[model samples]
Target: MVKSKSIYSCVECGGRVLKWQGQCPHCHLWNTLVEAVAEKNSTRFNYTNEISRVQNIEKIKIGEEPRYSTGIAELDRVLGGGLVDGGVILLGGDPGIGKSTLLLQALCYSSCDRAVLYVSGEESASQIALRAKRLSLATKKVHLLTEIQLDRIQEVLGKEKPNVAVIDSIQTIYSESLQSAPGSVAQVRECAAQLTRIAKASGICIILVGHVTKEGTLAGPRVLEHMVDTVLYFEGDAQSSFRLIRAIKNRFGAVNELGVFAMTEKGLREVSNPSALFLSHHEEKVPGSCVMVTQEGTRPLLVEVQALVDKSQALNPRRLSVGLENNRLAMLLAVLHRHVGIACFDQDVFVNAVGGVRITEPGADLAVLLAIVSSLKNKPLPIKIITFGEIGLAGEVRPVQRGQERLKEAAKLGFVQAIIPKANKPKHSVFGIEIILVDRLEDAVTAIF
Candidate 1:
């Protein structure tokens, strides 16, 4: 008989120690170590007798992996065309962010030709059925399993041999070999490893749902993400109806791909044209508002950037930004003061990206500065004008990636004029649109005002 021993593991890096500590020594993260049981090795010489051989690289066969559509065009786009055979996807989001709803719809639609299984460790079969009925999805061909044990789930997968399967959540599943409770660092790592091995061995496409921490990151050992084939994050405000799914990591496809969806009473519906969702239709041109083009993966997106600057009453002015970086706003304001002679030293600045979408790239810097200057001067930018560029501390306007694509997207969306970086100037002009190239921040300010 093998004996089990207690050990401490770090949730962030999956490093094990003999005792618990306030901080994880391996990852240097504070308060992440949790107690878990270590599996004993009973047979030291139990090795595989099968011999392994190495083959020449040129002789290896190369073929494209087969893919299956999820019935949702947006979802398919994020997954790099469709669900690849033997691929494991990790989907994480806040509570009630429609992660399960999206998978349920896809599984039902895929049930038409492929064998699909829906495993729910958190909810019962009747609850899943209730949600299916609410969404008006046909569930006759979909198989439902409500189990949390690793052994039982593996048993079902082996018996059913499903082409596609979804583990509603990876945190709830616990292994009998580990004495630790479910959701612990050890249990999550073990369960995820087993599921991944099963998927690869049986060619079953498995999607694992994950929980997010308070800081809006996936809650588990960091190794969980590295072990999977793809990692997707579902982001949107609870109050807002619009939701955005972004791929953070993909082994078979492009990263940073985005999928837009709108939540309705029926279910989550894909937004074919996501650019329109981030733009506001005002009766007239408004001050402090500017349109900017951003690239999400291969798709070009047009979003509205808005800013407000007001005189501050206190000694320290507050600088707040939503859907954009706060620190970058301060940097842009300083550049505006140094280069353009526009000072907002005692002004409270608030910047926002229209709609619920967040802009992480620096391409929005120029548009943000323009919006701030427009609000300060109380002058509306010319109607149907768009802008996108990066601003440096030296007041230089830096070019962004795929400038031609951005311009084409803006022109297609009926924008008549674009103020872009001089370096991004295209060889041929886009039809129905005029481009104003600027080399410095002062030139951009002068051209717009």
Candidate 2:
């Protein structure tokens, strides 16, 4: 039998080292190494100890995996219809960001055909019940357990056999087999793996809540993400009442799916019109404002892109961005200077995606570029205009996917005009929207100005 040993792990990158050092040799993150006790391997894999037989491809049978509805349409959309049996989901967010409320509300309102267990290592039964009361949630089918020990939770799982189990957080749960404290790398990994095993062995679906670090990542080893079937992160500003649940990874559904919620006095209310919520309110469309339609998973969302260009008085012009990338902004400025006649070489540039929503797709490139130009020239584009396309280094406007869907969304939102790449011209003409196909950045500037 292998003996237990102590090992050092880098908290930043989850790299392991046999000995401690001032800095991690792999990730170069300083003062992030912590020691943890590693348990001996109780199960070994080798050719000499083979047990289960492998079946041939022709003899194997396939069937659709079963799923249960959480009774929330927005949640079901993000989850790809419903939660699958024997699947594990990890949800992480900032403190007081409504992670617990969302999960509890789902459990409380879900169709109670099966037993539901909520094992909380962070909050007690009373605390959860009080919050549920405040949220106006009531349920008798849900069972609550306040525990952190892995063995006790496993015992409950075997006895109750709930169709779905929710662990409040994986960081606070620990296994007795390891000497490491809860929230450590070893403990988090072990707890997650054991929970996953229990979920798969039985038909119970497991949802694990995770605490996020100051760096905005899950507070555990990176391997914890890989061991789960789905990973979701909550995004919203602390000052704002809006919340967005985004799926980073999903095995059974489409990834990058988004669910929008509004925090009210009672609880979270699903937003029926996400585009209106994510748009900046203004009586008139301003010079620095532009509209763009970007696809989030299977849904096409319209968002406002804003930009400000001012003459710099400081040594280095400030290049700041929110809900967008800084490096991409710099590249777009360079492209505008090189291709379009507009120049912002010595100006401080700031770009933002309004309403705390992030636009990652390249289709928003044209809208951002147009907004910057509009700000620089002190001119506003048409109020009923929407634009989306990819910008190349050579100043050519590139086509984006699902062009018709984008145009249709814009039209539905009352947009009448659109600027898109020439290559993305639709096969059939849209009824309400007038599409202006542009081949070069210079042509777009000319059309807008």
Candidate 3:
């Protein structure tokens, strides 16, 4: 019988320890030291001895080139075209955020003639089948397997030799060889490394689904994301139906590309022009609301900025912002007070980037600050005006990236006036709309108000 050796491991960073303590000195996580047993292995492979018997380095040769498209436009866009041959891609998102649904929908549309394996460790075959039925996908060549054992998954891949394989989640799959439990840092790291090797060796495109942490980062150690060839993050409001898939790391394609999708009663549907969905239809112009053009990755997006300012209730006024950073809003408010003398310290300020889109770019600085100004003054911005420019601490509107794209998106959305940074040169005059270039925030206020 093999004796079990006890070893302490940190739960947070997966660092091995000799003994347990009240606090983990490595990851700073309390009560994370747990003793795990591993079967003693007396025999080990001697790779150095084998290398001594081997010959010299041989000539390098090129390998096979084969890739397939999932037929989803938004997914393809984020992937920089399609899945690469022998690529390991990881897709991570919040629970119940339609990550599984989106993957199943994509697989359903793909490979009617080629064999594609869909493995799920969390759900049963019946559950996936019901979702497939709802998606109305004819899965002729698509195969579904519900298992968690790493050996079984490897066996299926070796036997079936599918063109593409998707693991519903990597956290749930565990190897009996590893003493650590599923979803643990050790298991997650080891399992991902094995899958990457398998995909590269067999020339298979494997897409692994991952769960996200509360901090909106991919769950598991940071190393799991680094192990894969491409890392795609599914982002959007849980309350809203719209979903955005963004590529954070892509070895084969563009890194910052994004794909937009909408959840329907049937399944996830791709939105070609996300600008239209974000724009609200209002017959009359509302006070404290204005339109702005912003860029997400390479694509330009047109969104609305709304602000509401009211009397303060307590000693400290409420500063609420949704889809926009709260600290940035407070900073902008301070800038308005100090430079422009807007006197917003005593009032309750609420600012939001409409359509559930989060705007972090300095390009939206002018739009958001102006919306607050418009709200405090009870003034309505011109119906035709749309603004895009970064606002400085000294009340200057700075230039934004891709000026032409922002102008084109605004013009396509029927905005007739634009107050942009004077530093940015437009490629050509846009037809119909009046472009008002401003150097300072005060100039923008004068042009709009």
Best by TM-score: 1
Candidate 3 regions exceeding 4 Å error are 1-14, 20-67
Whole-structure CA lDDT of model 2: 0.88
Compared with the true structure, all predictions reach lDDT values of 0.93, 0.88, 0.83
Worst 10 residues of 2 by lDDT: 43-52
Error of 3 at 366 (Å): 0.6
Q: Ten residues in a row with the worst lDDT in model 3?
A: 43-52
- Per-residue lDDT tens digits for candidate 1, residues 329-446, read 9899999999999999999999999988889999999999999999999999999999999999999999999999999999999999999999999978899999999999999999
Candidate that would win on lDDT: 1
TM-score of each: 0.96, 0.93, 0.89
Clash tally, candidates in order: 0, 0, 0
Q: How much lDDT does candidate 3 score?
A: 0.83
Q: Best to worst by TM-score, what's the order?
A: 1, 2, 3
lDDT of 2 by residue, 164-281 (tens): 8889989999888878899999889878988887787787899999999898998888889999999999878999999999999999899999999999988888998899976877
List, residue by residue over 384-434, the lDDT tens digit for candidate 3.
Answer: 788888878888888988998888888887888888899975979987788
Clash list (residue pairs), candidate 2:
none
